[model samples]
Target: MTVLSDTSIKKAVLSGELSILPFHDDALQPASYDMRLYWKILISPMRHENGRTVDLRKEPNHTFFVEPGRFVGILTEEKISLPLSMVGRFGLRSEFTRHGLVAFGGIQIDPGFKGRLAISLFHAGPELIPLKLGRKMFTVEFNQLADQASKGYDGPFQNQSTFHKMQKDFILNAHTTSLAEINTLPSEIASIQHRLTMHETFYHPKREFPSISELAKAQGVSPINDITELSGLLSEEDDIDTFLETVQKWRRGNNNDE
Candidate 1:
């Protein structure tokens, strides 16, 4: 098997031997091309037997946050078609790995496979990770097979270009566990509800507590809605840690004044 070089990959794409819809020349790397994250993702519900699909496009800014230790399935933005002569290997980009995200599940594209790749992403980092729509999250490296298979891939996953729910039978049969583990759904939901209720009681916008902007103003500082806006307010010489410390001091002063 020979791994395709950047030049060969471009040639194959141009000659119609390979197809990557909505391709961008800038996405081409030295050996692989970057694939962006799509808008939809599948996540395991509190119940182990059920799964849920989340569409980030329905949310503001087409952004979704994945909590640490959560596992979700995402699709690639580009639909790819591979001829029988080639196979594709998918891998997580280094940038995401640095944030402790690991890609799991189907990593290899069988010859003749045609679809947007489905990827299972596991967040192993300590902090929540934000995934933005259309951001490159993975890379695909194409390789020429030694010989074309007599029969092309025609598996259950062929042409799976959208978020797909895991079949119930597949889940029940694939992973066997004790009855206790299978019955934790109710407790999990209750726990989640309790946390949400507490959060609403303490921090909901409707509560009497002053908004971040109001607090900032009371402390004689510009209001900051988010980390991005806070960063913008800082000079190049000002480090984020120092700025955050100053904000904390101001917040404390405002509380004392109150």
Candidate 2:
């Protein structure tokens, strides 16, 4: 098998050996063809479920943001078809890769395949990646096989129409969890837990409060040795009413002594 040069690639496309719709002269490269971004996209929802997305074709904007630390699926502007004798290899354009965009896709296009390419993109960069419609995002190089395989590709994704039809938008451990929001979840949970702990310490700190016996000793009262009486007053817990009564009585006795 030999890699097809630009001239050979053009000849094959012209002769129907390789089919690409909406091909542009500018997109033709020295040894490959550029694939443009299509209008439709399904982004990882902003911390939400239900895949609930919008079609960019219907919207006024021609751009979508590949948010930082999130993944998105997009379609190619051109439809592709390849004969069994030729295999294609594709990758994200270096322009997009320079900005921390990672594209997940198969390395080779199986023969006898026809469909719009679905590229899943992840933004590992710090900022949003604004991708415009019709932008050339991928470069695909074709190679001619010396011998055509016995069978053509007939997998589940052979003739997929849309990105959604090709694969799931995102796979997460929790169904209600959103991959886009995964970055901020730990901080949010920590904040809530801290607040709850602070509230509990401020309002209900029985663990830190002294017991009735310790209070009696501090006040110079006699060693009230009856466990039954202690239980009656404390009731297996710290009784605020009992604590208040005991303090009041001690204070009154101290006043008398003064």
Candidate 3:
């Protein structure tokens, strides 16, 4: 089996023997094509727990932070199609390895395989590693088979293009268990309800507000309750400071009249 060179790969792509959707000519390397990270990822959860799927595109900067010793499964941005005479394999880009990230998937691509590649990444560095969307993270190399296989690969993960949770039932159960625990704490719920009730009672707008006549009676002054008077005073002022001074003078006159 001979590994395909850049020229051969280009020829195969043009001849319809291979297809790379959303291809970029600049991403083609000497003997391989660079593959970019997709927006979706599967985060490996804690021990005895179920993993969760996250879409990095929905995150800030379209990025995800993976702590040291954490593992994540990511998908490739490009969709690939291989004919019966060709197989593909992928490896981590040198830049990622330099940052102490280990990529462990795409060891083999069977003949006639077609789909986006799923990459398993582990952060082996002492510091957290940030994986960004649309970054070139892996290199895919194609190989020509000696002969076409008798049968093509049609396994369960054959056309897996999106991130999927492996233990979906466990995630559902964990969510249900959390709700059950919260429901059993009636005292805590009651305490929260009481606090909310007290806050509502204290801050009721209608109860806290006093009418202009009531305020004037309390201060022993005549109420300047006419809207037309206030509007005329405001219209006569050229600036905010003048308007404020006029209002203050009006208040002082009311206090003097009392």
Candidate 4:
């Protein structure tokens, strides 16, 4: 795919072919844009292959719970209208990833892909970041299509307005007997916790729990009321590498579950 240049991206933005406002990047390169995180994350139940209902918006604004190593999808403030010939993908910045954060999602827009673009976002980190609504999440880079295909994403997810949890219902109806035998639930929970933490550390670094005690007060971690006790628990763990790896795995798994 041919990558769009900074100049072309600006042109597209100005012409209304691509929709995003308050564009703030020094270079304005198409390889990446500086995106901000949206505060409101919408979670939904996974769907079945036969198109049966698993969830019916039972909880509004209560999307997926992003923990470490989970891949949850969310939308963006910017709405896109790609040309019938151009397609692209969204990628998370490395600077954010180093902090144990990862983001992904952008479908292959065919030659006839139309309407506003929806991003499939996932976080694989160690901390939970309560993303606000209407926040910029990531920069999108456009790529040229190889002779424009015919098929586009006009399926169930088309014209999706908010964060679409397209996989929730399926999980709810999965085979309980088989899932229990394989020990799935525990692993899934752990993954969500891991990624959510990474997202917190990377996207919302300043807000991470100051110490174990502070973390405990929150639901996931232990509840250590005293600062001294929290400090002691942190000090006891010396292997930084092990800790990071464990968190990362958890976040990735969380996304897969969604």
Candidate 2 C-alpha lDDT tens digits along 1-258: 899988998898899888999778789999999999888776664455545454666655777676676667777889889898988888899988999889887868888888888877777777778878888988998989999978788877777777544456462211333344778888999999999999998998767778888998999989657766665645457778766877887877853431
Pick by TM-score: which candidate is best?
Answer: 2
TM-score of candidate 4 on Cα atoms, chains taken together: 0.46
Off by over 4 Å in 1: 46-51, 167-258
In candidate 3, position 172 carries an lDDT of 27
The CA lDDT at 253 in model 4 is 80
lDDT at 72, model 3: 71
Using all chains and alpha carbons, the TM-scores for the candidates as numbered come to: 0.62, 0.70, 0.61, 0.46
Q: Note the Cα lDDT for every prediction shown.
A: 0.78, 0.77, 0.76, 0.53
lDDT of 1 by residue, 48-84 (tens): 6544567788867888876665666778899999999
Predicted candidate 4 versus true structure: per-residue lDDT over 1-258, tens digit per residue: 788888778777788776555466553654655555443343322322222221213323532234443344444555555675677666555554655555544435444444444544344455654444434455567876677657655666566554445443432233222212235778878999999999988987785336766656665765558777756554565777766777787877843332
Candidate 2 structure lDDT: 0.77
Q: What is the lDDT of residue 151 in candidate 2?
A: 79
Q: Put down candidate 3 lDDT per residue, 94-128, tens digits, no spaces.
A: 98899878876448888878888876776776666
Point out the worst 10-residue segment of candidate 2 by lDDT.
Answer: 171-180
* TM-score, structure 2 vs. true: 0.70
- In candidate 1, list every pair of residues with a backbone clash: none
Distance from true location, Cα of 92 in model 1, Å: 1.2
